[model samples]
Target: MQDAAEPPPLRSRRDLVKELSLGMVAFGADARNLTSQGNLTPAQTRRLLPAGLVAAIGGELVASMAYLAMGRWAYASAALVRQLVEVEYLAWAVTNDPDDAWEWLKSDRQTRLQRWQPGKIRQRSDGRFPNSDYHAHCEAGGHPVPEPAMNILDHRDQWVELSLYEAAVHGTATWHYLVQAVGDAPVTAAERHHRLIDEAHNVWRRTETLDRGFLSPANGSDA
Candidate 1:
């Protein structure tokens, strides 16, 4: 049976993190707040995270946040798409079961996420940095992965959800990246960005098509 009480709406990133963090705190999970620490600083995380797998997943999240904030919808979606694949890598770290790890993609994220454990927070290896870096602070340091992170990596029908990000959002976010690639020079920038975005769209669509061929139909999605 599910909890009948509704949780409060998570309209901001801070809210989401706070909600997740509360549970982990009781376990003596990393105590430093992400905002207080370096939240999405990949350069810092890469060096600090003990496991390469954690670094990779954390890097993808950083890329997603960076691209999305810049209005690069396709790139943002791309980052998220990669996370779907990378979750398998993370799972392999935990279970060492290739078959089970691969299933992380087809797994229903919403259902699995409901089982998410509280996220860990750790003190920095050095005091020079005021706060803990999210990835390095994990219990594994760089080895085993947590079940919650595995669940968080799964995408809920990401094939369709990604399409919405690529197509349904009016391409405004897509345009943001394109504009920066070219400049305020007008025609050149417009043409350059358009071509770049179109190229990215085609690549993502093609990849999705290829991935569809491998999905297990038992997951309820049609082949």
Candidate 2:
């Protein structure tokens, strides 16, 4: 019998993009097939979660590579990228609400508020976070956790959410501009990176949509 063939070595971000996108597509198909017949087996659920995580990671990597291609010359572009990062971080700060995060992304208002005073989530008269509980809990505790001097949402989950969000925004924005900014780079290199970033972003977007569409309702159904 012939030996199994070896897989090709990945050479660039583009390659990673292709791999990640393909994986997500496959996973989604499987998930749908399984759901249609019956619920996923425990093992399948475990596998799916990891694949979703991987897709999310790929999205961040793609965005980062794009920004890196732009180099220091794209200062305005870079700042915009940074703004994306900040918004993502703030998203986590406010809890993983994409709606709230995207809302802040559209305006500098939240950033300005955050920038001016750390952990300052604007609240309504009822004293609830406009959308989050980050500050409310901290404030209401009888022995209030001394607000960390710097970033307010400093907990591990909060930090990870912030970090992931920043990475996603920076990576996506960078990927979008990489081609224009790095045209001077070798053609093949540019194209590869661009494709990688695009693929990564697409995978992330699809995965997120799937998660929101499927998981949220499923959770509600359980409740």
lDDT by residue for model 2 over 1-223, one digit each (tens)?
Answer: 2223422221223343344334333333443444345455544343333332323443444344344433422222222333333332332332333334334434476665654232443331234323232222222121223432122233333222222333344344433332232222222433444555566555455333123210123312111
Candidate 1 lDDT over 88-171, as tens digits, reads 234222223223222332448673354222121012112321122123223111224454234223543432233233221213
Q: After superposition, how far is residue 123 of candidate 2 from its true place, in Å?
A: 28
How high is the lDDT of residue 1 in model 1? 28
Model 2, C-alpha of 203: deviation from truth (Å)? 1.3
Reference-based lDDT, each prediction: 0.29, 0.34
Prediction 1 global C-alpha lDDT: 0.29
Residue 85, candidate 2: C-alpha displacement in angstroms: 4.6
Stretches off by above 4 angstroms in model 2 are: 1-154, 184-187, 209-223
Clashing pairs in 1: 30-121, 50-142, 51-142
Instruction: For candidate 2, report its TM-score.
Output: 0.29
Clashing pairs in 2: 63-171, 63-172, 64-171
Query: Where does candidate 1 stray beyond 4 Å?
Result: 1-53, 59-63, 66-75, 94-223
